[model samples]
Target: MGKYEKKLKEMVFRLGYFTRNWRQIVHLALATEHFGVNNRTYSPDFSLFGKRGPGKFLGIPERIRMMRARAFMGFIPLKDAVRLFPGYAARHGYLKGEENSGD
Candidate 1:
C-alpha cells in the first residue's frame, strides 16, 4: 500500500479505537493531497469536501456513526457530520451553494 493508504488505514484503525467501529470503516476512494482544519492541514480519510446527506458517498454512514461516537468520547464538535458537510461535499464534487436537487 502507498503512504497515504497506510496512513489512512492507520487513521481508520485509530478512529475505530476512538469511534469503536473498526469493523466498518468507510474509506474514501481518493486520497487528499492535504486538508485543513483549524488552519492546520490534516489527512482525514473522509474529508468533508463533498458531503451533503447520509447517502452521498461511501463511508458516510460510518462517518455519521463516528461523529455520534465523538459525543460520548468528548466534546469534539468538529466530529459532527453536519459540520463536516462542506469539506465532504467539496471532495465529492457537491460544493456548497451548489447542491444537487435530484431525486
Candidate 2:
C-alpha cells in the first residue's frame, strides 16, 4: 500500500477498536486468526486461514460454523494477530500493514 493508504488503514482500524464492544472484539479475534497457527502448532485439523472453521474438525457442519477468518484478520484491532502468529501470517501473505512486526 502507499504511505497514505497505510495511514488511512491504521486510522480505520483504530476506529473499529473503539466502537466494537467486548463480544464483538472477541468475535473479530476468533473469526479472523482464531488462535493463529505456526508450523509447530498446525495439523490437518487446524488451519488459521482456510474455508473450514475449527468446528469443522470436530464433526460440526461447515455451513454452520464458517467464519471470515482471513477477512476479519484485516480489521485494525486484530492486527497483532499477525505479529503474534507471524509464521503462518507471513507464509499466507498477511503482511500488508504489519510488515515488520515479527516475533
Candidate 3:
C-alpha cells in the first residue's frame, strides 16, 4: 500500500524469478526496511515481503526448497550455501558457527 511495501512486493516478485538466495532476500528486506534489527537478531515479515500467489505463494519455503534442491543436485556448493544462507544453514545445522542452535 505504501511506497516501501510496493517496493518490497516488486523485489519479492523479482526474487521469485531468480534463485531466491537468502543473502539476496535478506539484503532486499533490509534495503526495503522490511527487516527489523533487534540485538543481533533479524525479524523479517515474509508474509508482506514475500512473493504473492499463483504457485508457491509465501516464497520463503519455496526458496528454501529450491536451495535444498540446488544443494542436493550439486548446483550449489556447500560453502556457497553457507555463505549465501549462513543463518538458515546454521539454524539447520548444515554449517558450523551457528549463532542460535535451536530451530
lDDT tens readout by residue for model 3, 7-37: 5765665456345445444533333233422
The clash count for each model shown is 14, 0, 0
Q: lDDT ranking from best to worst? A: 3, 2, 1
Provide the lowest-lDDT 10-residue window in model 1. Answer: 23-32
* Candidate 3 global lDDT: 0.49
Per-residue lDDT tens digits of candidate 1, residues 3-103? 68855765665455545422223222221223332223455454554354535566655656554554335444433432333345344454557543221
> Candidate 2 lDDT, tens digit per residue, 1-103?
8988866766665466435433433333343333323322223453444335655345333322232244335643356555334545665677755555332
* Whole-model lDDT values for every prediction: 0.43, 0.45, 0.49
Best by TM-score: 3
Clashing residue pairs found in predicted model 2 = none
The pairs that clash in candidate 3 are none
In terms of lDDT, the poorest run of 10 residues in model 2 is 59-68
